[model samples]
Target: MKILKTIAFVGLFVAGTASFAQNADEIARKVHDLPDGKTSSFTAVITLIDKSGKTRAREIASYAMEEGTTDKSVLVFKTPKDVAGVSYLSFEYPDKADGTAVDSDSWLYLPAMKKVRRVSGSNKDDDFQGTDFTYDDLGKRSLAKDSVKVLGEESVNGVACWILEYMAKDAKAKVSKRVYWIGKDNYVTYKGEFYDRKNNLQKELVCEDISQISGYWTTKKMTMTNVQTKHKTVYEIKDVVYDKDVDPKFFTVSALERELVK
Candidate 1:
């Protein structure tokens, strides 16, 4: 749920000690367990760009916190009067003791309808609010759902990276395989590619403006592009603060309907 409409190598043991540390399974666990923050607040600007070069932008104020083993987050729209006051709240749970995947619970509040709509698990592959990103792309998916392998290493923009590939265990999954270029030193995800069920490249994601924010490596800008449709979505993070005091009520469905996050 901490995701914002946002691998292991198995190569032979190289000569250096650092290269031997490139175990695929270990990198998968490390990336999945990256430390973000107990509480975080940030403003996200979502921009939709069509093939004709038209662009529409939406601003969302997002807050996230950890409650016990559950992670809670809320996105409240701020600008563009047509979408102002719209909010989305989600609760992400950890995997069960048996390693079964537990889908996140999400709800969306529509101001025009004055109603709350629940985002079902079946809609994970659907586009998130017409953007290029899908609901599954915006949530914390369990690592156990995929088989990760090391594809080797490469340099992305002069940054050394480990190329990791992931194949979804679910045969019917919309995304069958994914590849990522993750930073070796900081463990930050720098680039990624998503392949559809037919194993064709569907979307590509690039993370830029990487820097340390409150001791945490943060990607301030992300762009996701659809290869087939030529539609793209850009997310820009601003005014980020970690461990900020937040209202418990902000993560509630009732609060979303009542415009508490406004």
Candidate 2:
């Protein structure tokens, strides 16, 4: 009788652990869907401050949309006098996801050049437009495209975190692997580590200033660092309001040209 009772207790413990893992996986899956597939618009003010203390600032009004499995995005800059007419469209597919981005294809629209140029495939390691996030860093993955394994739990900045290991199931992925630190209560990602083809640590991302936007938890600022060159980029969103109706035309090429700052 003692042996039977002990076996039953162990079986129940195993079942409970499995259930906890499943719940954590489901919560992690929802983190990427905050944007959904809806067309949206926002005004962003970018401020670039170099290590030398030189500063450049621009206010941009733009629209974006993500569709289906393709995940196409367009950013039209309507801001500072110089970069006003600049625009770009990025079409991303989950080339790889092991808790980090390995590679992606991006096309930039050059108004003066009047042509679109394709960027790199494994360019996630590269600085984005001389800023912080690489092209691959902007790419997002749905849970269906990858597998998530619970890597136990940890504490980050006094917050409990569930470490999740995400791996691209696609055999042709450019990235070797990725790991994410997901907040236990809110399900927001606080940090991520990316690995290169040889599985070397290539990049790190830290997200801070989480706020409630449109009744959802959102990060107001994020910093991405490239370990290879010791370069860093910081992105901050201010004066943010959500659920505003965005005109479809705002996302088009015509809008990119006409919305130049005075």
Candidate 3:
């Protein structure tokens, strides 16, 4: 009886320690690690699938500067000749956990239309290019801005992962709730669910085709599906190079005026 009790105590201790591990902050840290501020260039294939299951695909070349508060970024359409010179500029910031910064300003410049639009709290949920993903979904958020809570562990695609959830404090922010699955060993997010103001499952984003670049776990493919509309967008990354020299001007408003073909 004494030996059995001792074994039971040992089991409980192991279980307790495991339960205490894997919290929200850890998961947030992994997400923050996704992009190092270092520069890089890549080609992406953006596919749009409508509720009718019609798919439209476009190839785009993009350059990004992640170093500062500017979050200078630009995307230029490469294929589908009609979109040539269709470019955009934007500065993104990491949001605080409580989402209190709903008023934080982000800018966008469109060259084909020659318009620079600003995003505000009220219209943050507006779609980008009539796609399923909203502005806030593409917006940046610093891990320091939000508090993370680990919702425990589960297996995703046979990989053990930590489930984490986050909320923004600024009651008015677009996505009120988000859940993430962080791989146990790789620390890459494999799946996530975003909930809307009504706490309904608004969208689901899945990360796939993960490969290591510069010793970093990265996903070369991602898909965002809108549950409300049954529409989906697929993003495929190519020629991805990390910490390489990128032309600073590639991220400017001029990027919108030029046909950036590689």
Clashes of each: 4, 3, 14
Candidate 1 lDDT, tens digit per residue, 46-134? 99999999999999999999999999999888988999998888899988899788889999899999999999877777888778888
lDDT of 2 by residue, 31-57 (tens): 665553255455666666565557676
Superposition TM-score, candidate 2 onto the true structure:
0.71
lDDT of each: 0.87, 0.65, 0.71
lDDT of 3 by residue, 58-161 (tens): 88777767755546566666767666555655566655556444234555555567765665656766777666767666545645444567777899888898
Per-prediction TM-score to the true structure, in the order listed:
0.89, 0.71, 0.79
RMSD of each: 8.6, 5.4, 4.8
Candidate 3 — which residues are off by over 4 angstroms? 1-22, 35-37, 68-71, 93-105, 254-262
Candidate 1 accuracy as TM-score: 0.89
For model 1, name the residue pairs that clash: 8-24, 9-24, 9-150, 10-150
TM-score preference between candidates 2 and 3, better one: 3
Candidate 1: residue 152 Cα off by (Å): 1.3
lDDT of 1 at 248: 88
Worst window of 10 by summed lDDT in candidate 3: 253-262
Which is superior by lDDT, 1 or 2?
Answer: 1
* Model 3 clashes, total count: 14
